[model samples]
Target: MPAPCHRTPSIKMVRGDITEQSVDAIVNAANSSLLGGGGVDGAIHRKGGSAVLAECRALRAAHYGRGLPTGQAVATTAGRLPARWVIHTVGPVHSRTEDRSTLLAACHTNSLRVADSLGAATVAFPAISTGIFHWPITDAAPIAIAAVLDTPTSVQEVRFVLFDDAAYEVFTQTWREWKQ
Candidate 1:
């Protein structure tokens, strides 16, 4: 493990559903299409309702017609969700042939920037890219923690919402080691 990363803001790790978090903003590990897909992306869109999708459509028509790029983050209304905003970011698929760690880190940093732009004080995030994207939790967790810690933002509370015991355990261990 690397040396502990010290951050000014408060970070919390919990095992829960990202969509249920009552924060100012929630991050969606969305596909590049910006349209709903499986896993976290699909759940968020399903739970947040049509208002969220409506804003997404507007974003697509105005700016992201070609789909959101990997590592870039965008904001949309939270709609019926407990949050005021949804920060959508596309995670890079893990590949043994190329180094894409920078893209993974950008997902967190860019999401935080978008959340800060919306004046969101509290933000919740899922274990991005660890799912169908195939990024190993061992590598992804540290990148996630470092990215959120290193980013300069107005966000006060950063909550990592891990979906399962394995994911939660990895994040918990990483968080402890990173804070050491």
Candidate 2:
């Protein structure tokens, strides 16, 4: 094969809290409300402080009055978090009878698009929907990785900030396998 014409971003797997990531943007595994709730959303809201909530409130009052739809993404000031912007994407809940993986993948793709629009060179993402939404790590890992790998964006670096060993390992192994 010929040399690649474009750059594929450097992917990093850091087993840590996404809230503390010091990147240009951090992807929040947010709920539709965007007012903040359990898991990553709650942590980001608590750590990022009132300014984050203020922006979220403004977003709700403006375009998201009915709440953000699943798979779509929006950006807000990172507030006290180490990043400059926070890209919030609501992931779909896992359903056994119905395949909702496309929505999950869209969460990653749309978040990257929002990050690119902000000129964010680096972004950190949490394992969206794998927590409260109950998306299986086994199924979610490949979808997340493929979405990032397939999407075209200006971001130079993408880091998956996993909170636990299970999430981290799944991402790590999935990425390694995908590279082959």
Please write out the lDDT profile of model 1 over residues 53-138, one tens digit for every residue.
99899889999999999999999999999999999999999999999999999999999888877878899999999999999999
lDDT of 2 by residue, 110-164 (tens): 9988887888889999999999999999899899988988888878999999999
**Top of the candidates by TM-score:** 2
Q: What is the lDDT of candidate 1?
A: 0.92
Candidate 1 Cα outliers beyond 4 Å, as residue runs: 1-7
Candidate 2 residue 95 Cα shift, in angstroms, is 0.2
lDDT of each: 0.92, 0.92
- Residue 22 local lDDT, model 1: 96
Error of 1 at 88 (Å): 0.4
Question: How well does candidate 2 match the true structure, expressed as C-alpha RMSD?
Answer: 3.6
